[model samples]
Target: MTVEVGSPAPDFTLKNQDGQEISLGDFKGQKAVLLVFYPFAFSGICTGELCSVRDDLSSFQNDDVQVLAISCDPVESIRAWARQEGYEFPLLSDFWPHGAVGESYGVFSSDLGFSFRGTFLIDKDGIVQFLERNGPGDARDQQGWRDALQDLAA
Candidate 1:
């Protein structure tokens, strides 16, 4: 089962595209977090989804919110993709354990050996505020996330 709304978010530490380690706990008392898990870096659908986030960064990430994109791809791959896409938000590498974190989120596809599309909005208290998951080959509507944030703000 996936992490659900009102449930505590599972804390994790993974390297960012820059090779810097980041943890969910780092934002616990500072800002709510938008955790995005995709299958891979540079894949067509993955690129499109993240590019949208790149283009709408202010709405997706700010003083009140933080965006962390996760993938099973290696740090080197994510670094190249992020640099090419001009993504300002952190793209975290769930590569070491080979999708361990994604599995924790219940988004990992064992047959495909990667994570599907999973998005979670966690409040500053570490409780999940929003949760959505899409299967492989499926795309996501980010507006849902925006709407959720708007609700939080209200």
Candidate 2:
């Protein structure tokens, strides 16, 4: 099921690097959510993209918005990666079900055993306001995310 703009986002609870259970509905009525799905942890492209977000965290994560990065890697791997990279935001592990959340968002590659790069911005009301999908090895331009957040604010 491909999640589309203006539709309700699929809700799921996953464990972050710190072993915290975070649910999509947790941000409802408080903050918009930016769900970032990536293939693996500690990879070069994924590191570059996520480090960009980490560097400009205030833009993606503030009172109005929360950024959640998800991957199929095990919790221990993500925990180590987050610590190694000094990532302040949550790095969620979608490992137990092995990409269930990614599959729900239509970004999981079953044959590849991982998720492609996918981004979804869901509003406080649980509606998806923006969506973008990129295949493996394709890097996403975060400017589009900032632009969408600007529109969401306006």
Least accurate 10 contiguous residues by lDDT in model 1: 1-10
TM-score of 2: 0.99
Native-referenced Cα lDDT, model 1: 0.93
Task: Put down candidate 2 lDDT per residue, 1-154, tens digits, no spaces.
Answer: 6799999999999999999999999999999999999999999999999999999999899999999999999999999999999999999999979999999999998999999999999999999999999998999999999999999999
User: All candidates' lDDT scores?
Assistant: 0.93, 0.96
Ten residues in a row with the worst lDDT in model 2?
A: 1-10
Q: Which portions of model 2 miss their true places by more than 4 Å?
A: none
lDDT of 2 at 123: 98
Q: How do all models score by TM-score?
A: 0.97, 0.99
- State the lDDT of candidate 1 residue by residue for 81-138, as single tens digits: 9999999999999887888899999999878889999999999899999999998699
